[model samples]
Target chain A: MFNPTWAMTIEMVIAGVSVIGLFAALGLVLVLMERRVAAWMQIRLGPNRVGPKGMLQSLADTVKLLVKEGMTPDGSDKFLFNLAPYIAMMVAMLLMAPIAFAKDFRLWDMNIGVLYITAISSIMVISILMAGWASNNKYSLMGAMRSGAQIVSYELSAGLSILTIVVLTGSLNITDIINAQADGWWIFKGHIPVLISFVIFIIAVTAETNRAPFDLAEAESELTAGFHTEYSGMKFALFFLAEYINVFIVCAIGATLFLGGWMPFHIGNWEAFNHVMDYIPSSIWFFGKTFFLIFVIMWFRWTFPRLRIDQLLNLEWKYLLPISMFNLLLVTAIAILKWHF
Target chain B: MSGSTIIFYLLAAITLVSAVLAVTTRMIFRAAIYLLFSLIGIAGIYFWLNYEFIAAVQIVVYVGGIVVLIIFSIFLTQQAGEQLPKQKMGRQLFSALAAFCGLALVMLQLAQHEFTGTGNKAVEPTVANIGYQMLGVDDNGYALPFEVVSILLLAALIGCIVIALKSKPEKA
Candidate 1:
């Protein structure tokens, strides 16, 4: 009696396998990117020996991690300790399913795609907490607590900013949102308001994903590897994979919602130019926009120091939340006023 | 049974088992973790309903935010590595009986009732329709309730802060 559509089954299998591949590929590339970026910022050559400019360095590191033994601290909650990393990895993978990679590429084009994305993205907090509790380490616990606060606080503004996009597009589907930007992307069409919303979205997502500067949860100096302090081997790699995948998903959402999805740039009354814009393949454009945002996030990570937990909460509740709320009001006003340029 | 029905039953069993464990587990921390699993199962049910938004909210708010908060509180209490004392036998028996009776009552009520949606049919919950109704743009808008929920969330935030901040003076 068990039946699923053949197409759906095939798509699910393909998507699952591809994402696993993507996770590994992205992890390796981001590690290299991080090393190179760090080196450039500090005037040094990042890993150069491991297979030409350290291209195979991540592979070697992966093998090293695989061979290393995982430790379970005495008095740790053993069940949760093992389960936590998988939960983190699973939720992150789930978020990627709804994103419109190209014009028509997505796992599920549910009507409430935008809201769903926001909702599922936050589950990382629970996994972090589980890891912290299971680790039986004070530092890990503290890191988890800070991360919990960070995610919950930032979610308010992130939700509000996303609501602004929903209002502008008048649709919740990512595909529909992309289609709304067919003529002109929200960034250009909504003008100043879109810029404001875009900035809010970027900051809120950065906090949400626990990237650096806002990464109080895993601060190396203070928490000593933070929530994953006790984790090692492939288990630790799972958390690492989840983090980068999350970065990619959030950036893709930002690109799809604010900039055009597959739609390319063109001024009005230029049909021929716009047609040419369409030829550059949607996935390429989508990835380009997404990577640019990821680069920005990585830049923020390297440049800014971590914020104190209290300051992080205050930034969200007092500043980001209120500003995003008012920005939503402003965006609504402009949309109603038909102030498109 | 159809595939969806079979899947539903399986998921329901998992949900019920996890939920029971969540409450009945002797270890307070383990109970919390079980509660997390129970909540995730509930989200799975939401996905089955095609209310992807609600499912995600279920994960984000309940599993992610609330469970994390509860775990943090557990840590802050400094009760890690200690098993919570088991409930008294008599109390456990009474609780189990009460739960069984409650379930029986609900089943009885459900069996007797055969409510139908507007045209002798059931309405599938669609996000678009729900969103429209929420904003009061079409039909009777639930705008007031939507706004009230924000107030409810604000109260929750204040309450959490108040509870977390309240402190006994440090021991001399």
Candidate 2:
């Protein structure tokens, strides 16, 4: 029999390698999905020349980026400039640990899973700040500053919205949260409050990840690629990859929290319907829910105009923050009263 | 040594080295970054002890909130690329003396104290236990101190708003 320590070490190695592979695959697929969605919205064919239906377009881009020289500016802080992208990539990858792709399949099922995610994700802003500051460029500094403020502000609402679900479930463990949805998803069962927090959560996370409408940090016309103005080649690609991965992570968390995670849709006393839903694999359910949310986020990107810096702050502090705070209270009262199904 | 013992030593080394670097680094921005690593190392130590809740809180409050704020202030107030001005000889000597004294005091205290490990009987540092302890009305509960801390935070928030609020410009 294999020693427990050796078995654990092997398991960890496998998990680490698979996560890196998943990052690569996710980066490719998400980039393709974003391009296609954008193209469809914009009345154009996107990257059709790369491969069949342009499925390998991101792969081509990756290859191109890999070969391109990663130039560090003469005046830039060489040490930190190189370190910044890796930090961004590390934060993105570390977020994968607590997420459950399927029932009985996860990395580290620590007790404080949700809290762990929020804590680690808060570190994302530091990477941006480092990149901006290290680049020694005016635009980069401005972009980094804007991102720092934006992320710090939006984090409040995002956290409060997440706490709404945590309040309902009375647990922080991802598995426990999922298992609590066995009867029905919180969005349906918890009713108005859950729906409100879900909306707020989506908006908050969109801003948190520095996505469209809140993509002021990298506003192409305004800041010339923002904090990453100095980065090139694979270094630049790492940031791009990190962005996509962050989007996926946040969407997965959203799916797990607001949607039923891997749980299938079922109504009380609908045994046949429930069994049919159960026949669908849990991983498929998780991915479907996550992708649907991702599509919605991408849709938001295509539809809405980017908010100005002040307007973005206003939307968070004056609107989302207050509303989410109130919603948290409502959810708490509901949870206390056992009003949720 | 066991794997956990090796891990503990590694974390301690990281924490101590990064903390020293944070203070000694001439570049203000590098100091902040080093401080961040030191805080993260401390969080890792907490995780190593299986106090995951405390570790998360450490990362969230220190690395995320405080370090970011420090970096922000540095960005605003200082040229990050510029080296910080060197301290005067007297000031440097005094600071070193102070730090040495503090370290010696701590070491002396550690040598004087007799510590008994709780071993396997120690309470699990789970979130639920932390929550209960924070709010519980029992003798060991921290409900009073928790409320006091919240009140203190509220006071600080109000004070900040008060200080930052702009006065109306007088018409010339």
Candidate 3:
């Protein structure tokens, strides 16, 4: 048997490497999935020539980005220009820690799991702002400012919706939240309030991540390429990769809270059905739920038209925020009355 | 030093150095970035103290909210790429004296206080404990102060809305 200290060191090293690998894999798979989804919606063949059914398209893109020169504009802040992508990547990676992938499998299961995610995710806006400012481009600055306003506003509803779950669970820990849903998922059991919050959560997080219908920050027709307008090569790729990874993280968190996470669907007194669910690996269940959420988000991206910036803010401030706040009160009352099964 | 102690010192160094840079930097945008780093470092210190909830709040409220607002305003009002004008000699000297006096006062307090480290006996800094402490009605609770703060924030929000409301355009 190895010494405990050495074993821990090895474990940490392995975990670090795996996380990096996961980042790369996620970036490749999500990008391909998004393209394929978009293509199907638009009725076109997407990226069929690269490899077998375009399986290696993202890899080829990665290689191209790696070799391309990452140029710093003459007037740009060199230090900050270089630092912004790393910050974006770092925030994305930090968010991965508290997320439980499978039963009892998480990097850091801190007590403030949900809170930590919210807090760290908030910092993502800064990196966008930094990237925009450092690029020294008008379009970049405009994109950054739009993103700043968009994220700050949407964070409220997203946070309130997350709190609905927190109130229902009576705990902020992700593990406890997931475990609480073992009997039945919050979306099904907590009734209308939970359903309302889940819908609000999806919309808010879509805005928060700068996804479609809320992607005023990077409106291609208006702002060129937005905040990363000046970035090219691998530097731009980092921001691109970070965006997908963030979507995955948020979807994972949403799955953990609203869906049963790794917990399989079961009806009360259906012992045989529950036993059959148990046979499927917890990791598969977790990933299955998470991917479904991801696919739904992509569906939103393809189905909806991007909102005007003013309409976007109005949607959050006028509609979603108030609804979510009221939903919180409703959820809190239900929790107190022990109304949920 | 052990790992934790080393980590603490590293965090302290980062906080102090960034704080100094924040105040001393010539570029206003760089100053804001430094301030962001200093705030993050302080959050790191809170994490080192095992006050995870407090640390997260610090990052969320200060690093995320306040700093972003500051940067946004700077973007609107200032030419971020340009260096700020150099301070006049008298103003610099006066500010130096004020800073030195503040430092001395803090040092004096540090020298006088007896820091009895609770070590193993320290209360766990969990979110539940903090929630109860803040909302509890007993003598040790801060419920009254908390309510007052909420009221104060509500008033501030109202004041902002009032100030921001556009007056009816004069009939031309």
The candidate that wins on DockQ is 2
TM-score of each: 0.91, 0.97, 0.97
Q: Comparing 1 and 2 by TM-score, which wins? A: 2
Ranking by TM-score: 2, 3, 1
Across A81-160, the per-residue lDDT of candidate 1 in tens digits comes to 99999989998888887888887777788877887887777777888888988898899888888888888888888889
- Provide chain B's TM-score, model 2: 0.93
Which lDDT tens digits does candidate 1 get at residues B1-172? 5557765887798889989888977778888888888888899898998777788778778976788778778877856678877789999999999999999999999999998667555445566676677888446788988899999989999999998996989999
Regions of model 3 farther than 4 Å from truth: A1-11, B117-120, B169-172
Query: Residue A330's C-alpha lDDT in candidate 1?
Result: 92
Give all candidates' CA lDDT scores. Answer: 0.84, 0.93, 0.92
Instruction: Report candidate 1's interface RMSD in Å.
Output: 2.6
True contacts kept of each: 0.63, 0.61, 0.49
Model 3, position B55: C-alpha lDDT score? 92
Q: Is the docking of candidate 1 incorrect, acceptable, medium or high quality?
A: medium
Model 1: CA > 4 A from native: A1-9, B115-128, B135-172
Q: By descending DockQ, how would the candidates be arranged?
A: 2, 3, 1
Give the best candidate by TM-score. 2
For residues A42-130, could you state the per-residue lDDT of candidate 3 as single tens digits?
99989898999999999999999999999999888888899999999999998998999999888998999999999999999999999
DockQ of each: 0.52, 0.68, 0.57
Compare the candidates by lDDT and give the number of the best one.
2
